[model samples]
Target chain A: MKRIIEVKNLYFGYEKNLVLEDVNLDIFEKDFLLIIGPNGGGKTTLLKLILGILKPWKGEINFYDDNISKKIGYVPQFSSFNKNFPISVFNMVLMGTIDSKNFIKKYKKEEIEKTKEILDKLDLYYIKDENINSLSGGLLQRVLIARSLVADPKVLLLDEPTASIDITSQLNLRDFLLELNKKITIVVVTHDPTSFAQIYDHIACVNRRLFYHGRGELDAQLLEKVYGCPVELLGHGIPHTLLKEHI
Target chain B: MLEVLSYKFMQNALMAAFLASIVCGIIGPFIVTRRLVFISGGISHISFGGLGIAYWLGINPLYGATAFSLAAATWIGFSKQDKMSESDLIIGILWAFGMAIGIIFIHLTPGYAPNLMTFLFGNILTVPRFDIFIISILVLVITLSVLIFYKGFVSVALDEEYSKARKLPVRSLNIGLLILIALSIVTLIQVVGIILVIALLTIPVAVAKEFSIHFKKIILISILFGISICLLGLFISYYIEFPSGASIVIIGSILLGVVKGVKKILKMKLNLDETIN
Candidate 1:
């Protein structure tokens, strides 16, 4: 497989506090990589660094042999989007296809037809014209995922893709992502292990540094090492215990 | 009504209200949805310094106000490195500094400035034919641009990070939005004045929001609401000898209250029905 992203000794910080330290990783084309860790483990920070939203204080991130400043599709945490924002589902997804380099270029007919096909695959064609504010959380998540997919990115980064939804929606999103992983290199920052159990080919645990990189089912010992505690996995695909106590 | 139309000044004021409200209507929803009311308010107030400088320099105050406000808008748009609160503080400082500069410019300008009150309180009644023509063309341009770039604007306003990730030129679009807002503020200053400009920008959109679920519909309704309030305010001022800007703001406030009250009552009734059913 072709190498899509290469991160070398990545160092980043917000003001005085250092967030990421000497991180090195290589993401191959169409790799389903899950980044899991405790809260404030700099998972989102790393994702931002890879997406070129924030420049690293040290080290470098390269996409397709180029500097990471090149654009990549990003599915941000649901909390970041204002629910009251007046936008339709179709328009939201259409945004993914917009070329920043050519601002004045209009969407071609072929692109619209392709977007419809993606929306249909996501089972979101019915809500194409629906107000985004009125959609259910599950529907909105699918729309966001579709939005990212429409960009046809070389690498797709999702920050906690299933953080605040119910069990069924979480499972549905997991299945959807698994299907998506077949096409693009997927980097998802998640806290829930079960949500990524069947989908992820490798797990990258981050706590200001890369702690582990391995294949197959997640090992509790490795998670404990990264989290610095005897963590317990709980029901409904969530991390219930951190440091042997409920958290 | 016929007599009102007979006067050219009245005709110009009416045309200005129509054109300005159209601009406000189209752009207002974006501002309200993005929760950039404070920023817009800051820009409008700061433009006073530009207006004052123009008066001091014996030039067209509109040109100075537009230039100063556009500069402030650009600064606000590009200063993303700072936290939101810190950025807001910067905008606030500019706002006050702009006003101070305007006041000093007025002080520096020689002779009695009889028409200065017109800029401060809005002289819609004395709007020149050329000013009316300029406002109409600007409103047309603004409306057309919004239509052409509706999707880009919606995405950026809704979620800028996602927009950028999708390679949507988020920064440039943001700057475009700010520039449009600066132009709107400069144009509307003649209709409602700077003091009540924010009120005009926010109130119609706020009221329309309660009634419409879609952005496009909200904009259309906001234009209707804005035009209605302006005309109502004009009539009230004509009849009761009240200040035009104050009267328009009062009309907008009343409409906002009515919309909020009606929405609350309808929501309560729906809840009651659900409980009984």
Candidate 2:
């Protein structure tokens, strides 16, 4: 498979405290990559480095032979936008056409139809006219996905897709992501162990360092090393295919 | 009310009030939605330094203020892009620096300071034809830019990171907004007075947000309702001998109070309906 992103000898941190050190990773096209780690383990930082939002302190991130930024779709975990802001779901999804060539141009008929299609696929078509603030967490997350995916980006990056949603919604999201992975490359940073058994193409364990990167059937010992704790059992809610308890 | 129009300055003031409400209507939602009230306050005061420079140079104070405010706005935008927390501190420092420059220049200017209260608290009734022309031009420019870039403004204000991911020129759009903000602040100085500009920028839109969930509707209601208050304040000041600028603000406060009361009633009604259901 051709590589879409390459990070070499990366080092990053906040002012005084170092977060990531000598990290390197390669992301291939059409690959579904899941990054899992304990809390405060620099998962988000590594993702930001990959997304080119935050600059790495020492190393470089290359995007398919170009240093100029690539158009990577993003679903942010914490938007900090006031939910009471006056935007309907349709308008919110219509914002996905930000990449339209004509800057400040009106949304085209095809763009509007495309937004509707994405919303329908996410099972959120019924609430297209409703206020965004009134949307439930599940619906909101799906709308966010629709917003990012409307651009038809080659790479889609989601930061904590299941952070605030309930277990049932998270499971439904897993089903949705599995379906979405058929088209574009997907990179996700999640702390939820319950989402571990979603059968990603590659699972990279991050803890201030790229400790393990391989298939989903990662042994219990490697999981323990990445988590810096004992993983004698797979998570209580995780699917049975996730672990064999070889710790 | 027809008799009041006999006076030319009263006509100018009313026109200024009308033009200003429109500009505020269009720009107000962006400021409030993005939580830039403090930054607006900072920009307006920073432009006062330009007024001081104009006074010293014997030039039109409005021109000086516009130039100064834009400079301050660009500086603030660059600083904010560099470091967000550090920018907050810089805003405070810039706020004082601009005002201090203005005050020192005013002291240095030869002759009486004239009625400085008009610049500080705004006596809209005394607006001249030149000021009205400036206000009209600003409203036109603001209206045109908003019409052309409505979606860009909405996306950038609502979620800049998302906008960035979509490959929107988030930085340029942000800087453009700050420029509009700078012009809005300069144009509004004569109506709301530099001291009360934030309330002028915010209160009407804040009231409108309660009644509508669409940007266009909010902007429309803000303009229409703000004009109603402007005329009402003019009449009240004419009859009761209250100051004009202060009166308009007072009416806004009363309306805000009424809006809160209505919100409470609506909430109670919603709860009642839920209980019955």
Q: Which stretches of candidate 2 lie above 4 Å from their native place?
A: A15-18, A64-71, A79-84, A216-247
* Docking quality class, candidate 2: acceptable
For candidate 2 chain A, which ten residues in a row score worst on lDDT? A228-237
The digit string of per-residue lDDT tens for model 2 on B165-251 reads 556777888888999999998878888778888888898998998888877899999998888887787777767877777888889
Residue B194, candidate 2: Cα error in Å is 0.3
Q: How close to the true structure is residue A167 of candidate 2, measured as C-alpha lDDT?
A: 79
Shift of residue A178 alpha carbon in model 2, Å: 1.0
Candidate 1 wrongly placed segments (more than 4 Å): A65-72, A101-103, A216-247, B81-83, B108-111, B144-148
**Which clashing pairs does model 1 show?**
none
- Minimal lDDT window, size 10, model 1 chain B: B160-169
Give the TM-score comparing model 2 with the true structure, all chains together.
Answer: 0.90
TM-score of chain A for each candidate? 0.83, 0.82
lDDT of 1: 0.79
